[model samples]
Target: MQYSIGELAHRTGLTVKAVRFYSDRGLVPPSGRNAAGQRRYDDAALARLDVIRVLRDLGIDLATIRRVIEGETTVAEVAAEHVAAVEAQIGVLHRRRAVLNAVANRSQPEEASLAHQRLLLSEVERQCLIGDFLADALGDRPELAGIARTLTPELPGDPSPEQVQAWTELAALMRDTDFRANLRRLVDAHEGGLRRDLAAEVRDAVTPALVAGIGPKSPAARAIVDGLGRDPGELREWLDAVSDPRRERYLELLGVINGWAAPESMAPAFGWLAEVMAA
Candidate 1:
């Protein structure tokens, strides 16, 4: 039996335009022309159209479809390959969804909207993102490499859900203008021959004073402050440089990304010691 374009479209449950599109692609070509020169197809074209429909519904691309049509490969081979591809895509989608869910549970980060694209970055791309951030933050001064290392967030190859969320937040923090400026100040202090970590020393000294019930303005608190070898007035400058809330939060996220234990906060100690120094 012979079928006109409209007749073939009606029988195959396709729009006339879709039927013409396949015909133009030569997936279903005309068997002959009618007397008036309208295209007519036979059962063979209809059979080919059915094959095309099934493959299209399975999400196979036309290039792959053409291979099947031209006998370059078998339908079974295509289905098997497509099945694996589909399964792999599904796994990726699930992971992406979980990462988004993790982001949603936290306070909305500054670049929360771009979190998905950031998560899609490969390891090399991820490294480049931090590298660019460090270059922008610390400049090209190679002498400051040690300080840059302390700021880098190293997300592991196989990260936990928590780690992924932490990296997302940390990446957003890296873009913060004020946070970058604060980091620059830290670099200046380090380069100005204050390579010692005054913040760490103060936090360590004040932690003991805090547990021992020594008041921040008490003589014992002053004793702990003096023990750190920092002049009473200079601790405040280090505190201002290092104790930005965002800076502390960045360190918390860094710990999560690098698989370190949650860090005890330095804020209480910094505040206490700063108060002690003032006293």
Candidate 2:
């Protein structure tokens, strides 16, 4: 028995227009025309429309649905493919959620979001992300390639919770414009040879004075400063740059990312030198 479009809509819980749309798309074509030249569909059309509705609800695209209906592909094949795609999307959302959670705990949601993006990069892109960052820091010296690799964070295929947290903090730090400039200043002076071992020079001079509890403006402090041979004017900028807490934080994050030992901080030496210079 043939059913009118309205009947098909009623039977399938669809609107008449929706039924007509699928029929027009050749998904459930009219079996024949009625006496008044209206479309009429047989039981076969009704069954096909039921299948179409189920597939549509499953989020299968029209082209793929067509292939399934036409026997070009199996529903099992489509289901498997869709399951993989959906699982991939879920994985990304899970990672993003984890990053956001990390941010919520840290008070820097924006930076944590940046870390999420960094984690999404392909291996080549990941390498480039770090290469470019280090290039900006180390001036892209080929001879320093081994040094650069050592500095780069190699996030494993399946990183630990600690690594993700470390990466989130590190990525955010790396993206900060001020932090980048601070890093460049420190690196250029020391590693780039603009002023070799400037920090070391200050640390050596300042540590002895610090150990003796010498005041910044004391005569003894003055003698120590003079022995360093760096004019105070020349020393101030370097001291200020080294004194940034983020510099210390950066090293700490690097250790976490690369599985290295926690680096010894020069904060005490830098702090003492800055105080003396300010005096």
Candidate 3:
């Protein structure tokens, strides 16, 4: 049986003009003209129209839909390809949202406005930029290469907004000359674990004093410092090297990107050590 274009449109919930356009495009051709010389569609055309409607709803372009109707491609093939395309688009959108959140979290709102230029970086590019900074900062300290690797940030395939923001700000921090110098100084101080050893001793001896609220120049602090048996000059040099705000922020951002537990700040202990040296 044949149905007029009007009847087919009414049944399919498509406008009459839409049905005509599809017929003209040969996607749903008329079977034959009716007695009134109007377009009429057979059951086959009606069924094909149903498919076109579904494919269009799924965001499949008209050309691909036409291929499906023409039997040039299988519906399953088209659907699978479309699904992959849609997932890729969603991934892009996810990354874009992460970038936006990173910019918004900046304390300086103007930084966010300026961040759009850097938002085009891919994950590999991000890693490369960070690696270059680490290489330059660490210099030829082959012994400290492992430390450099640990400090490097790797963005996961699906990162949180906080992670993205941390990475972005960290990248900016890496470009600062003072920040680079501070890191190199700290790295140079690591003579066969000398830096770590002193830090461990300081933490152990001075932690109790800190807890007791002993002032840095107090007699109790002096006793702790002397008992630790570290050279005051070396202690001063180490504190001067590592006790930088950007250095601390770099470690914080590393933790953020790696999902590591927040590191305890040694700034207070270092500040106390500096005071003991002055005494």
Candidate 4:
């Protein structure tokens, strides 16, 4: 029922060094010593070593394993805690695999990969980034308080590659103070006056022209402007205020982050309106 350190190692299929480490760590103590002063283990020691090996293979760290062996914690409790830890590690590995797959598919340059990796944020980080930005921008507006919550982006539990990329970029943009200011300005202007209704009207009127491939400077642009039932000059001014490239990019990124289908570019529509009004 007793075994030397080397014999225990061979019987348990563990390395001799590993067995010695456990012995030194007091996880598996020697019951006695042989005449040559070598360590010897009894049945209880061998049984304890077996449990340590099993727990270690289950990804339990040495500290927790020691706690379980020392009777400071139950094996079931340790197993439960370690299971949660292992599950979390698996989730991280899954996300890393997803990122690598996306990188491989795009054949992206090294710099692009580095940029994407830098921008990638965990779900909690993504939510905090967006929530902080919106809080700073629309937090004081009682009317928009609910709307801001509705507009908040939550990436799906299992996101597509495009969604992941969009989220990374969106998080970066959310952290930029200038971008936050720009969005605040847009929100403020929209809430201030008739400009609130003008955006939707413009979207409707110019969508046809953009679809028709009408150039911004074309005479046909005037017809689109006329359809909105606004003075050409007034329409042009409104377009100038709202046709920001960053705003468009924000919407594009928002669509992806929110799992919305891609929206048509409003650039062409606004372009036509601006040209016609300026003329």
Which residue pairs collide, candidate 4?
Answer: none
Cα lDDT tens digits, model 2, 1-279, are 999999999999999999999999999989899789999999999988998899899989999989988989998999999997777566556655655565566657676566667665555665676767787776756766775776688665445567778876777677677877876776655553437566677777787778888888788877777787765765676677778998788778888877889987889887766776777
In terms of TM-score, how similar is model 1 to the real structure? Answer: 0.57
Put down candidate 1 lDDT per residue, 15-66, tens digits, no spaces. 8898899999988889999899999999998887878888988998988888
Q: Write the per-residue lDDT of candidate 3 for residues 35-153, one digit (tens) a residue.
A: 78888889999999899888888999999999999999988999989887787677667778888777777788778776765654765677678877888788876777788778888
lDDT for model 3, on a 0 to 1 scale?
A: 0.81
Which is the winner by TM-score between candidate 1 and candidate 2?
1
Ranking by TM-score: 4, 3, 1, 2
How high is the CA lDDT of each candidate model?
0.79, 0.77, 0.81, 0.75
Answer with 3 or 4, whichever has the higher TM-score.
4
For TM-score, the strongest prediction is 4
Q: Candidate 1: where is the Cα deviation over 4 Å?
A: 1-114, 121-125, 231-233
Give the lDDT of residue 106 in candidate 2. Answer: 61
Badly placed stretches (over 4 Å) of model 2 are 1-115, 143-147, 190-195
Alpha-carbon TM-score of each model against the true structure? 0.57, 0.56, 0.62, 0.67
* Model 4: lDDT to the true structure: 0.75
